[model samples]
Target: MQFENSREFARQLDKEDKLSKYRNEFILPKVNGKDVIYFVGNSLGLQPKTAQRYVDEIMKDWAELAVEGHFYAEKSWWDYHERFSEKLARVVGANPAEVTVMNTLTVNLHLLMVSFYRPSGKRYKIICEEKAFPSDQYMISSQVRFHGYDPKDAIVEIKKRDGENNFRTEDVLAKIEEVGEECALVLIGGVNYYTGQVFDMATITKAGHDAGAFVGWDLAHAAGNIELKLSEWNVDFAAWCSYKYMNSGPGNASGCFINKKYHNKKDIPRFEGWWGHNKERRFLMEPEFQPEPTADAWQISNAPILAMAPYLASLEMFDEVGMPALIEKRNKIVAYLEYVLHEIDKDVESSFEIITPADQDKRGTQLSVFLHGEGKELFRYLMDQGVITDWREPNVIRLAPAPFYCSFEDMYEFGQILKEGILNKQKV
Candidate 1:
């Protein structure tokens, strides 16, 4: 438990880390004419250094093959999407047949909801966290209205009382019961964007099933940030973006999941396109839709091979290091951050509250700090001083030390910058 400065601590951790070599694979950005601490991996991840090479391969094939690239490339573009399924399936703890890499995040959400949210007369409620991301709220509300139902009454959000910042499992279970027969779908973030709180996906999925409802998750911030078992959890469906902890670059292609149990369930309708048509007869130019019996059936159009190559390389990195080791270092790094944040004077604690859960098991790699007096001002100060992080509207500063590249030393060094920014300088 004894460590010196952030540098010493990081060196010690690096020496013991089996996955330390993985950092060499990504491109890290510098700030303020100096190398800055990047704790915002929960927002946008650093690019994989190999990403350019991966894309260049496809570019070379495209340049040489032209129209023939579909079947003639080094890796056939027609079946290139298939390459990622096996590795991506492993990251989410799903069978290879149940995962597919496709579409941007919100687009996938709407598509998955089309199949999951089959609202009827009296059963049209959607259960989600009260502070769910704005995009999700829009999607849910719009979906409810699309079904001739008012979102005001149909969308049920779970919340905690005043003076409380975290939601309890029992409370969520109780709410699901209270809304039982009426609830049609349950959607929650695997790890909430603002709070960095990891919800109990398996438990929530069970509760949703007991109530005869579909369960889905938005793993934008959680996908590669934590270990997930969506298939084993029996989650009806799930979707995630890869730009964050996956180091796939900004606006990279996303991934989706459809339980193996529902792969052949034609009754669960999906928005159809030729890409999703049955693989055996994909190029036959048939009018009838023949969906594949796995998550591939959910695909709409051809995925951008170049955009997805980064994810391919990143997922391979995950397989190389494994999740347990990353999670082990992640917990220690985050705990150090919490310890450093708490070491600040009580007066500062009274002003800047750590909204993210403190328990190692309840959260992942990030912490959301809520500033009372002047959050924006402090944010600007930190930015000017080369301390990089993200800000959520109203008052939260989110800092996430990504496990792949972030070290404990970076966390401790930033802690010093935070103290100076908040305590030594005051413009408000």
Candidate 2:
């Protein structure tokens, strides 16, 4: 698909887009009097228009039924989390029984680590990508410390080759083999947050399992952005937040995946609560903790219906469009975005360089641009000009052209704004 660096070409693409209708479903942020060209779905997705209705339904039930809402509401509060299993399972490619909605991403990571990150004798090291999101770095370090091991010895980081922005799959596999029997776990973000590189999860998972270690992913950026096959890949566990690509509201309930093999195992260590008790006997409240024979067994508390309502609202859209259709549109949009950026670089002789993978298969909707100079100033200019994107430390600006709400026109407009920002800096 040859892309032209013109507004007319972008408008033509938008006119031909099958998913163009979805753009209207979200409420875009306003700048001055116009809807801003938003390109930060990797940070926080725009709000779906139906989110309010979903929240209001829950609120109305609470107002009318009070304490009885647990049993009497239209959607019972007693089993609210159950509603997400089918949709989330489809999104992550797992059995419905293997997935469950629950606590936030990092919390789920910790809980899962308790059950899967068991180390003994000399087999205690964990392998993860270097410069993983700060929260994951902190979580892994703390978990290692909690297990009475110094992080320096227990954590093995897979760093990118010098001058490369992403890790090579072969290097990662080799690292797993190097750790061998000492590797207790292999955990990595499915889509790296900074460089927008999508890891080869299947190959990584296979290497970890062959090394006799559990494999898991933090799909915080990958869940709704790319196709995943957690169960088929034989991943032991995975977790993701709903607020980013899933387009759920901020700090919303997250989703987790546990292999079906682990679902029926009673001996597995976990932090449990009443909600994970067998539903048939939950009301009995007996002393014995008989866990649910599914991924729900990992739950440590009751569902927060209010926090979950917006997720349901967004899931409905995903269900309607399906991942296949979404991915189809996403690929084209990202290609166009890349084309526009290249065009800008040529036109302005700008120092901008895309740090994301050149191969479409190795990336998602995000394109992280490394601005060689004046990056912070250009980012601020883009923001002031109503081109919404995210800026990371040093010099990168991340732009995610989300398929659901972002249009080809938005990408073109962003390219124009970015060019202007660069040229304006040169004049100054």
Candidate 3:
């Protein structure tokens, strides 16, 4: 498909878009009184218009029923987290019983590691991507330290080849094999936050398993932005935050997946609490902990209803539209966005280099561009002109056109704005 950098071309594409109407569902932010081109959904999603109503309903229930709201509300506070099980399972490609909503992303990962990261004497090493999100780095290192292992010796990081920005699948699989018997776990972010590279999760999971290691993914960017088959892939466990592509509010509750084979195992070592105990006899105040026969077994506390309300509101939309439709639009818009960036690069004095993989299968909505011969002023210029993008260190800006709210017009307009910013800076 040939993409043009004209407003009419963009508007025409928008006119033909089947998912265009869904943009109205979000409450977009304004810059200088106009809706900003929101490309930061990779970092923080826009608020769904219905998010307010979701929270309001919970607030009303609490005011009217007090403690009884846990059982009597329309969507009872006690069972509020259960509402996400089915819908979220569909998002991550898992069975309803294999998925559950719980604490924040890193917190959930830590809890899952407590069960999955059992380090025996000789097999205590963990393999992960180099420069994983800082939170993940902290979590893995701390987990190793807690088990009385030195991070330097216990953690193996897969490196990108020299002069390469993204990791290769063969290299990742080879590293897993090299670690072999020493590897106890293979944990990586399904989608790299910095370069927007989508790792080959299924192949990696298989390789990790073959090497006698448990495999898991931190699906922070992958959960809603791309297709995933966690259950079919035979992932041991996984966790994802709802804020980014999921369109839940900032720092909302997280969703988790635990393979069904591990569900009812009495010997599974996990920190238990009343919330994870059998719900049928939860209030009986039994002294012994009886784990639920589902992913809820990992849950340590009762639902955070206020934080979860916005997430449920967003998941309802995902259930309605489904992931196939979302991915369809995502592929088109991201491709068009890449085209626009190149077209603008041809016209401007500045050279733009997209660090993300050109292969559609290896990238998602984000396009991380390295802006050569440009400085922070270009980033400031973009932000000042109603373009909400994420700027990393140096001169790269991460533009993630979330398919739910972004339009082709936004892409074209961004290109024009970018050209003007460059030309204006050259004049100075």
Candidate 4:
């Protein structure tokens, strides 16, 4: 697959792309009256064109039926969250009963930790990647403190080797084995936010279990971007935000997967709410809390229908296309993006180092590049020229060309814009 750095080549590839038509489904943003090349879908996905209609339907129901809309609307408000169970299950590779949509990503992770992160004396340590997303860091440390343990002692972070940007699976496995009897849980982000590295979740999950520990993943960047098999991997629990890569709106509701073996356990520790109670007797307000025999047992409140409406709208698109088709396009587009970056690097005075893994299976839609001899000014130039990418600390720029809306032309054009920005910097 030789990629060329020309508009004609890009357009030809687009002409042959089967998923290119799906780009029209999203409402891309504009810059200077033209569509911007959006590469921040790993941060906030573009709004699906159908999202407005989904919300409008809910708004109409509320206005027309008031409280009765819970039971009477075409998509009833009371059971709205249930709409995601099957669709989300397919997306995350789990049984319908093992998945549910609920609170935001970190909130769901905290709730899930209650049931899975049971830290007993001498076995209270948690293993996670070094420099995880800040929200996860806070969640894990706070959870440890809540149980009267110091984070310094209770949390073990797996560090990347010197001069390396990604964690090796062998190193992570060795750390888990080293922690051994003291490790209570192995929780890591499925796709790293900074480097776009995809961890070997199945092998890590097995190693954690073999060492007598629970394993889980925060799929904030992996949910729709990578293939996940939570049930097949025997993950104890997992959670992910729908906003990133799922094409849901900003800070939308999240999805969760809890293995079936933990479904009906009466002694399982979790914060309960009426929404999690058996649907048959929920309104009856029974004295005892009989949990739903599914992942819904972890629900702490009723569905946030307004927030979830956009998510359901996005899921409809995912259902139509399916993960396999999405992955197929993702691999090609990301490779083209990488190719365009390298080709541009060859011409520019500035050097660009891609920190993401070269293997498609070990990475997703994102390509984090270290722009040597460049700074925020170059990033601003790209943004001003209608390229919407993300910048992390230091000099790394994260470009996630979401396959749904991003095209090969976007990659080629971005390379031109980037090269121009670097060359212009040299003139000054």
By lDDT, the best candidate is: 3
Model 2: per-residue Cα lDDT over 134-245, one tens digit each: 9999999999999999999999999999988889999999999999999999999999999899999999999999999999999999999999999899999999999999
User: Per-residue alpha-carbon lDDT of model 4 for 1-428, expressed as tens digits?
Assistant: 98899999999999988899989999988999999999999999999999999999999999999999999999998889999989999999999999999989999999999988999978999999999999999999999999999999999999999999999999999999999999999999999999999999999999999999999999999999999999999999999999999987888898999999999988999999999999889999998999999999888799999999999999999999999999999999999999999899999888999999999989999999999888898889999999999999799999999989999898899989988888888878
Which of the predicted structures, 1 or 3, would earn the higher TM-score when compared with the native? 3
Winner of 1 and 2 under lDDT: 2
User: Each candidate's root-mean-square deviation in Å?
Assistant: 2.0, 0.8, 0.7, 0.7
lDDT (Cα) of model 4: 0.94
Colliding pairs, model 3 = none
Tell me the tens digit of each residue's lDDT in model 1 across 1-428: 75444557766866786666766676767776766778889889988887888888889998999869889988888878899888888788899999998988988999999999998877889999997888898988888898888889999999976888888889899999999999999999888888899998889899999999999999998888788998889998999999998888799888998888888766777898889889889989899888888889899898788888888877878887777888888888788778777765353534668988878888999999887776577888788777788988898889898888876666677777777777765533
Which regions of candidate 3 deviate over 4 angstroms? none
- Candidate with better lDDT, 2 vs 3: 3
Ranking by lDDT: 3, 4, 2, 1
TM-score of each: 0.95, 0.99, 0.99, 0.99
**Looking at model 4, which ten-residue stretch has the lowest summed lDDT?**
419-428
Where does candidate 1 stray beyond 4 Å? Answer: 2-7, 346-351, 426-428
The positional error of residue 64 in candidate 1, measured at the CA in angstroms, is: 0.5
lDDT of each: 0.84, 0.93, 0.94, 0.94
Cα deviation in Å at residue 59, candidate 3? 0.7
Q: Is candidate 1 or candidate 2 better by TM-score?
A: 2
